[model samples]
Target chain A: MVHSIDQYVDVVGAPVVEQLRRLGERLKDIRVVHVNSTREGGGVAEILYWMVPLMNDLGLKASWEVIHGDEGFFGVTKSIHNGLQGYPVQLKKKDWDHYEEINLKNREHLLPVLEEADIVVIHDPQPAALLQMIPNRRGIWIWRAHIDVSRPHHQVWKSLKQYVQDYDASIFSLTSFAQILPHEQFIIAPSIDPLSEKNMPLNKRYVNEIAKAYNLDRSRPLIVQISRFDRFKDPLGVIEAYRITRKVIPIQLVLAGGGATDDPEGKEILDEVYKAAGDDPDIHVLLLPPDAHRQINALQRLADIVIQKSIREGFGLTVTEGLWKGKPVIGGDVGGIRLQVISHYTGYLVNSPEGAAHRIRYLLHHRAKMREMGKTAKEFARENFLLTRQIREYLTLYLYLLKDRGRSVFV
Target chain B: MDMDTVPFYIKDCTLLIKMSGFSPAFDIRDLRERIAQCSPSVIYHHYFENLLAPTFDYPDFRNDFAVWVKRQLDDDVLAERLGMIEPYRFDSLEDLRTHTLDIIDERLSELHFITAVPPGHEFYFQEAITVVFETGHVMNNPGEMFKIMPQLTSSSIYYHFLEARRRTPDLTDDFSLWLENFGSEWEPLIRDLRSIDFIFYSLPELKEELLYIMQQYEVKE
Candidate 1:
């Protein structure tokens, strides 16, 4: 267990850490397996990279499992993703066949490990079918959907919900995103690892070196947005916002992101972003690799303001990371960004490029107000978004699920 | 010129505005008579059929009608401004029709002409006008309809049969299948009326089955 949960004492204080320890004691030695589609990139993988180790440190037997699929399988899953995020995509019979074929293959390799588990938490639509595939399953299965399914495409949702609605419980990032299912639904927002390399505090020399490597000038005001290059992230809208703000304030915008192995649409979106960026030197679009953690950390640290202008988001971990790093975030007023960006308190919630530009100019002009907002943002993250708080809730949920076998448990 | 001399342009063509629930007893006839005397080439209803048919139920009806008016009378910005008022927000369809007539009255007094085609001339105007009802809450726009109405129950029976299918696959015959097919087939027809054109309780010919479904599902207005 690399992350001992004790290391968070300095950031979140010893009392919260002790409380998490006390909650963890009730579920000691329980075999919990987290099944997801990828081990690298995306918020889910980055979260479990540290989360699994931390769970083991708390005296629980936690393991991470990855599902393997080819490009065809990934293509179908991407359609399901966009559909769940409210983009209408007509998924045909062949797409369903491809999705099931991949899951059926994965079920063969995963059955042995899954059969012996005390609890299995399936993340997102990619691995949702595994619960039905694993014959004579002994453990409680929880379907954790980490996307905004508030207004899903009716056809795509009909296909996906048939597999997940019968799970022991379903988890969503926000209550607004929860679907009407027969089983219990829990609204547990995604959290950030403050002690990880991507969010940990760094000194001046290393931060400056990473900034200079990316050709960023520290003297000028910088706006950074870190997310996967997905259409839902609205990277082009961020560029438009920068253009509107640049007319008055001389600022540089950095749209830095990496691709997840299981996401097939990243390259296409990256190409679109490049075409939209044109010859604007001030608009830096960096397509980094999956392991560029330190680089992302430095960019966020050196940034004057952080923007996560997503059109549809499922608890943006980038917003949490920026808040933890003491930078006010200007996020689109959608999805789970609404839960964090408190309008004028932490930052602003904007609807369009014009709204984002107005807020960007307002913050850059008022240095003292910006600093105060940043300070408030860090405290907000510390109170609500730390990993310890997330784990404590999970522990509580595990205990509750263990005690109640019925579909009545909810949070 | 004599003070009582009629302009030569008055003999160009006739302008007729047609609306239901309108009578000579109402004060609107004064405006109607003034419009008739103008000998305007355009008739209001027929001229705006293409515009009204696509926008009567659309939430952007006001803005779209304004654009159409602005294009037709490029120099009359006041007429364009009058076209943009959200008449649906009035107390009733009568109120909206009266407000429209008042605007036309103002335009006739200023421009000495009207900008509309005579009624009954449009090819599909009667069919388009037949679908619009004067009562019940207006959906007005597709965007607003989706926003206000519960999406789950809007077209699918899945939410209705949720409990029956809880334990196992609820294929209970071909009911859901039939409903899905029906929803897909009926989407285009209802979308035009509910989105671009008006839909009301008075559209009994097309709305009888819909009203039954709403009652069975307990869809309160």
Candidate 2:
């Protein structure tokens, strides 16, 4: 038999990792699989990538799979994403048929692997339709939704939920996202791995080198935020804030990020961002490749201040990444931003570019107080937002769902 | 038993005209209050007939007949809403049967409907609704509402007695004999109400039955 997840308590934390170890002692080698939309981008993908390995480290047979879709499929899914998030999307008959057809294709390739797994967790709208494919799966199929569906557009939500209802259980990121579906729902917010290369402390030399290479001046204060060039992330607004703060404390704004494989509208949004920043040398918009984690880490480290001025954010990982690096963050007051940036304590939650600019100027000018705030932010994240804590929450949910299946695997 | 169902009274207005012995070609179309001029019973009877009629004379009205019939007579608790609501709504009339069946395939969609709102609100309708906390709550049999709000004084026909006595020149000496004769006469038309295979041709006939119920409860002077 495999050893318990308690093997990870020292590496991660004692409370949850140790409990996982005890649970693992009893429920050893239980096969669990996760299926999600993208392999490289989005919070779900990033979390599952690290989570699967740690779960395996904890002695469970955990594996991960990513669903593949082409441009047409991605378009339909992006609309479905908006619909599920409460944006109005009028879906025609052909749209519904196209959604099922793509699911059928993915099923053709991925069906055999999913069916054999003990428990399959389908991630978001992309993999939700996989349930209709495996009618005879001997294991429990759980759906994991990580978007804000607190007030979803009815027509699309109802149509998409048609597929989700069949799963044995469902998991949501927040309480507001839970709908009146027949199955059970559990809340599991995402987390960042402290030990990962992206999060672990970086060398001062490397941070300085990246800043110099990116044409950044070390004499002036630095403000940075790393996110995709999408409307949801509000890259253009971030530029506006940098322009606003230039009047108070002259700091360079590094808008460093790139598009994911799943997003089709990235190029169009990128064009809009370029036009808005039009020939501004101080506004450094580095469209890095998808695998630019180390560059991102260095940018966060070099920054005297970090800001996530999003119009609407879906749990900004960049915010947590900044906080973990001991930088005071000024973020927008929406979605998971509220959860991350504790007002006047961890960082200030502002509404507009002017507001973000105001906070950025204040933080950049006050170096000593900013460092103290950064320390507070880091401790806040260490206590709450670590990957080990996230894994424990999930393990507990599994044991809870486990109670219905014949016998108690855990007390 | 009461001669009429509550839904039958609420819906059937046309047949009430014939029962009032008003001429069919009565050139009273110009009168503004003419439809309401007929007693509520006459309105109730016609509403039922139009609803139950297998074939409707007007094109806009054809889809209505089946739904109205199912409301009054279908024994299945979720009858009209199950099949009728999806088909007749604005978008689905394209391929008729196919489109209707596609929508009918859905077992549960959020039950979105209109409700009266308070005076100051600008919305023409409000989304005030609650999911039935109890199963079979919608299927209260024989036209009875499964639950009634005690604070509101308005009563229900299937659970509460009708209060008016029709001064029928043809009123029978005894109520039981009248009910038995009416039930027997209408047996051929009395849609097993349970095995409701066909829409009733006359929906307002229930108002005549309501007169039978009202005969039991005389309103005190």
Candidate 3:
């Protein structure tokens, strides 16, 4: 659903909307381009869905360009992603060669649009090397590394760092994930669109309908974990936690997530999740489509407890989504999840299935504590993790980078 | 890692004092006498001696090094110069001594280098060196010196404390004790750790991880 900045004025407040308008005035006529691996399925694409239009409405010539690549290209990028998140993945010489080869091919198709833009924001490792491939690129290029690189495998960081060190600046989700880059680094946590289809208020009737449609037993306290079926998301761990929690509390589990177009590892992980949930009637695994935003919203709203037990994460947008819906989230203690899920305040962070199950039982047993945490989670998300705050940071970065390079923001 | 031998020069004084507080095994008494004979104030004081255990004693090497120089050696100029020497900035005693000698080289010859090991206590020097250079004074040593030297090494205290934490992950009191005094590293890590990753580390494993970082950014006295 399309949303105007005015709609969020009441939700976020008049001050935030006014701030964006002022920033937009300084960024007027700026040709901003956001290039990433995919246009749908993933959080980056989902964010750009609203961010681009909002930027345009604010009077900037904002555009999003999706990069084209094949299975081999995505495979290499996925390995790079894993390596950046501190999982050791050895990229063979051909892996690096194949990555460069695909970007070079994409560069030919994207050069004209990329070079003409006043600012180009390349998201994650998939399109990081694009800057070097494009010729005479007349723009302030920023590499947005969306993975946790606090303890990156040395060889992998050595490879990725060379490609990104010369960019105008790098942006990470947290200060710990930041590297010793020559260029300045900024910490901008990813945000959820509070006014989007995935986050908008849904009626209890609609939520019940969606729950019935999914064959979920809402009578029992429902525990839902909504995320892509990725290994790093640790679908198995969530299942283990659910199984352990079910031993004491009569709770139902919903592992609902869709595969992103660019990610090739989804089916394998989905199958693993299926094997993990074998013959378990209490476990409801819903493989929703990319457009199942309302369903996701309803699931989050209906959930008694929301869990995102990712082993590694760039930033769990679903965690923010859960928090925004006033659900106390049990999230993995990694990446941007640490920034959102304040332990014992918003929700407890768990490391293992046993820990998750323990917290699950504690929260379920203590209804009042659960409700208090949920209330705090909602307010915390409102203050920090909303889309308007994200847009403000992006615009501010553009203005600062432009002014640093001797370009006048007023002009 | 580097070795050089220099001769001792005295300012016409034979008065010598023992440098105490190091492990009784280390020949610090002979070393201090050699140093004090040259100049009472120019004697080297180990950064560990002033540090209080269970509670970290802040490093005050400059003032302590100068007190000996001013009060004992009676050379105010040399005392002030020694006071100005920020030994805390150097990683090893060798580096600090070299830096100090360079500053006072025009005045003193080369004060004789004492190994700080007492007679018949050559084994303790080897043990101390092993702890300092090999295990970072936190691992594999069963000696009283190793147990007591964590505060002296600065980073070793954290390494040892983290090791204790790893051995008994459920011991909240031990973790709390470490957190109370040396929280600069643990608090940030704990605050930022994903809940799962926070529980993921066994105390020993966390120590090794912290030890790697401490090696890179060693806590100097």
For model 2, residues A105-151, the per-residue Cα lDDT tens digits are: 88887878788877889988887888988887878888888877756
- Write down the C-alpha DockQ for each prediction: 0.01, 0.01, 0.01
Q: Estimate each model's TM-score.
A: 0.64, 0.63, 0.65
- The CAPRI quality class of candidate 1 comes to incorrect
What is the C-alpha lDDT profile of model 3 across A1-411, one tens digit per residue?
555687788787764575566667777999999999887898899988999999998889989988888998998898888788778899998999998888888898889989999999999988888989876989999888777787788888899887898888778776556777877666677888987889999988999898888788867899999999988899899899998888778899999998887888899999988998999888988899999899999999989999999888888899999988888889987777866777778888888999889989989988898898888778767756788778876876776677643211222
What is the C-alpha lDDT profile of model 2 across B1-221, one tens digit per residue?
A: 44553221210000000123222211112111233243433333322222322111212222332332232333232334333432212221233433333333331243243222221111110010000011112221222321221111111221122111122232211122223334454333222221222222122233334443333322310
Residue-by-residue lDDT tens digits, candidate 1, A1-411: 246888888887664565566556667899999999999999999878988999998989999999999999999999999999889898999999889889999998899989999999999999998888887889899999899887899999999989998898887776567777887666567888887889887899999898888788778899999999988888999999999988888899899999999888999999999999999888899999999998899999988999999998998889988888888899998888877887677888898988889999999998898898888788767756877667865775776777643222322
- Count of backbone collisions in candidate 1: 5
| Deviating ranges (above 4 Å) for candidate 2 | A1-16, A405-410, B1-221
lDDT of 3 by residue, B120-199 (tens): 11211100000111222222111222233222222233233322242344532232333334436545433322122322
C-alpha DockQ for predicted model 2: 0.01
Report the CA-based lDDT of candidate 1 relative to the real structure. Answer: 0.67
lDDT of 2 at A176: 43
Pick by lDDT: 1 or 2, better one: 1
Error of 2 at A313 (Å): 2.3
User: How does candidate 1 fare on TM-score?
Assistant: 0.64
Q: Native-contact fraction for each model?
A: 0.00, 0.00, 0.00
